[model samples]
Target chain A: MKTRVIVTLKSGVLDPQGKAVHHALTGLGFDGVNDVRIGKIVELDLADGTSEAQIDEMCRKLLANTVIENYRIEQA
Target chain B: MKSAVIVFPGSNCDRDLAVAFRDVTGKDAAMVWHGESTLPDGIDVIGIPGGFSYGDYLRSGAMAARSPVMRAVAEAAARGVAVIGVCNGFQVLTEAGMLPGALMRNATLNFVCRDVDLTVANSQTMFTSQYADGQSIRIPVAHHDGNFSADEATLDRLEGEGRVAFRYAGNVNGAARNIAGIVNDAGNVLGLMPHPERMTSDAHGGTDGRRIFEGLFSALA
Candidate 1:
């Protein structure tokens, strides 16, 4: 089974990189860009019978820092 | 005082930290590899020096935090051993859940490297005993991800309890409340983004950092 994890900075957390990108887009004449938030996608190939609890543990322990970011796991 | 410095694969400041330990305590600090599962016996203090550990892969200090040696460091900390984490080491401590908050990229999105003025916020702890409360000192901080962030409640608790050890006299890194360093609840673990080991000697253009080591030695003694 393959899993996709999307990690994003929590709301109210400052995303400087995202802001810089947003600035560049505006400078390039893009219009109506409401907001930009940068995040990462991590794809994992797991063996059969991997439990959801185990995947959640992985996110909590290493994949995402709960203090500053949130992560969503998706099965594909 | 006996001490040990944890050396990760990419740690660049291990020697500087060991030198600081030797100079202040009159004893050579053991350089413990990150792969080791246990630290040497009788270590009163543990130093986690700065560097791009694991090349800052995944996230700053993420891989190194889960390394084998960190387990030992955590255990020692639980036993009330003094632990100091500097720069990347501070990131590792936060990742290891030894300290509160996460150090994100600098607000300005630039790698800041300079000697900045810091105020000793709380001198009552073992780590800051040599400095008077509100004393201004200069220390060098070199890092890209040194902006400290925690939820408002945790920040309030830290301030309320006087656990904040040092605060930037100027807004150097956009850390919450301009915190330069902080101590854990037990007051034995300190995590700071600045490199005190680099400022320990006058030859380094300042000896302001030496007082931290001296304070630790006297406290341990």
Candidate 2:
């Protein structure tokens, strides 16, 4: 089985890279761009019978920093 | 005071940190390799120097944080040893779960390298005792992932408890509340983006960084 972990910075946390991208978009004459936030997508290939709790532990322990980012796991 | 400077494969600042430890503590610091799971006995201070540890693979400091030696470092920290991590070292500390928050890429997506002003937010920390409260000092920072972020409640608690040790005096990295360094809940660990070891001598055009190690030695002595 394969799993995907999506990690994103928490709201209210300043995303400078996102802000710079937003600025560049506006500079290029693209309007209506309210905001931009950056994140990470991590995919894992696990053996059969990998439990959801184990994947959740992976995200909490290493894939994402719980202090500043939130992560969700999805089966593919 | 006996001390140790953790050395990873890509840690270029280990010697400099070792020098700082010797200069301040009057004792040569042990250059502990990353593969060793044990630090020298009775070590009082541990310096995690900056560099592109493991070439910033996966994430900055991610690989280095999980290295075998970090287990020993974590053990020492839990025993109330003073630990100061600088720049990439800060990232490692966070990844190792020694400090809170993750250091992401700079908001500008550029490597920042220069002397920037920083405010001493909490002078009571073992590392910041040489600085006065609210004092502004210049220190050099060289990193692409110095932008600090944390959840709002955690940030509030860090602020309320006076755990924040330093704040950028200007727009350096777009850090939250302009935080430059912070102390852990037990106050024995500090993780900062600025490089105090790089500025500890007059040959480096500044001595502002000297007080930090000096203060640490004095307090720990």
Candidate 3:
């Protein structure tokens, strides 16, 4: 089984890299952009029947820092 | 004082930290590898130095935080032994959940490297006893993610309880309230982004960082 994890900075957290990209977009004449936030996607190839609780534990323990980011696990 | 410096694969400042420890305690600091599950006997202080540990992969200090040696460090800290984490070490401690807040990337998105002024927010900590309260000292900070931030409640509690050890004199990073260094609730663990070890020797320019180690040694003595 394969799992996909998407990690994103929590709301109200400053995203400087995202902000710089937003600026570049504005400089290129792009408009109507309210905000931009950057995140990462981690794909894991796990053994079949990996329990949901175990995956959640992996996210909490290492995949995402709950202090600054949130993570979503997707099964594929 | 019997000191030990933890060394990860990419830790460049481990030797510098060891030298600082030797300078203050007049004894060589044991360089404990990250893979080691146990530390040397009778360690009075532990130093976690700066560098791109685990190549700063996944996230800053993320990979190194879960290493074997950190478990021993945590146990020693629980025993009231002094633990100091500097630069990348600070990030590791926070990632390991030993520190209160998280260090984010600099607001400017640049690697900040320079000698900046740090005001001693609380001089009563085991790490800052040699400095006077509110005294401003110059030290070098070289890191990309040194912006320290925590929730409002945690920040208030830290300030109220006097756990904040150092604060930037100006807006060096986009740190919340200019917080530069902090200690755990027990005041036995300290995590700071600045390189106090780098500033300890006179040949490096100023000896402002020496007082931290000196204070720790004297306090332990």
Candidate 4:
């Protein structure tokens, strides 16, 4: 099985990199962009019978920093 | 006093931290690698130096925080042992959950590298004992993700408890309330983005950073 984890900076945490990209996009003549934020996607291929709990623990333990970011696990 | 400096693979300032330990204490600081599960005996101070640990992979200090040696560092920190994390080390400590808050990318989105004025917030802690209350000192900070962020309640609790150690005199990074360094609730663990070890000697442009090392030993010894 393959799993995808989406890690994003929690709301209210300042995302400087995201803001910079937003600025660049506006400069490039793109409008109507209200805000911008950045996150990461981590893909993992696990063996059979890997539980969602285990993946959640992985996200909590290492994949994402809970202080500033949140992670969602997606399995396919 | 005995000391140990943790050395991760990408830790470039490990030697500088070790040298600072030796310069201050007149004894060699053991360079404990990340793979080691246990530290040397009778370690009074543990220094986690700056640099891109684990190449800042997954997140700054994330992988290094979960390494074998950090487990020992955390155990020692829990036992009242003094632990100081500088620059990248600060990130590691926060990621390890030994300290509150996290260092984010600088608000300017640029790496800040220079000497800046810092005001000692808490002169009573062992980490800041060498300085007077609200004294201003200059130290060098070189980092990209030095901006510190935390929730409102945690920030209030940190201030109410007088855990904020050093605050920047100016807005070098977009740190909350200009906080430059902070001590854990127990007051033994300190995480700051500035490199005190780098400014420990006069030849390093000033000896303002020397007092931090001196302060730690005077309290412990």
The lDDT of model 4 is 0.95
Misplaced by over 4 Å in model 3 are none
Better of 2 and 3 by lDDT: 3
Per-model B-chain TM-score: 0.99, 0.99, 0.99, 0.99
* Interface root-mean-square deviation, each candidate: 0.4, 1.9, 0.6, 0.5
Best-fitting candidate, scored by lDDT? 1
Tens digit per residue, CA lDDT, model 3, A8-31? 999988999999999999999999
lDDT of 2 at B121: 98
- Give the residue spans of candidate 1 off by over 4 A: none
Against the hidden true structure, what lDDT does model 2 obtain?
0.91
Model 1 lDDT tens row, B24-99: 9888999999999999999999999999999998899999999999999999999999999999999999999999
Over the stretch B188-216, how does candidate 2's per-residue lDDT look in tens digits? 99999999998899998999999999999
Per-residue lDDT over A6-42 for candidate 4, one digit per residue giving the tens place of the 0 to 100 score = 9999999999999999999999999999999999999
Off by over 4 Å in 2: A22-35
* Predictions in order: lDDT: 0.96, 0.91, 0.94, 0.95
Q: C-alpha displacement of B11 in model 2, angstroms?
A: 1.8
Candidates' chain A TM-scores: 0.98, 0.95, 0.96, 0.98
Residue pairs in candidate 4 whose N, alpha carbon or C atoms collide under 3 angstroms: none
DockQ-best of 2 and 4: 4
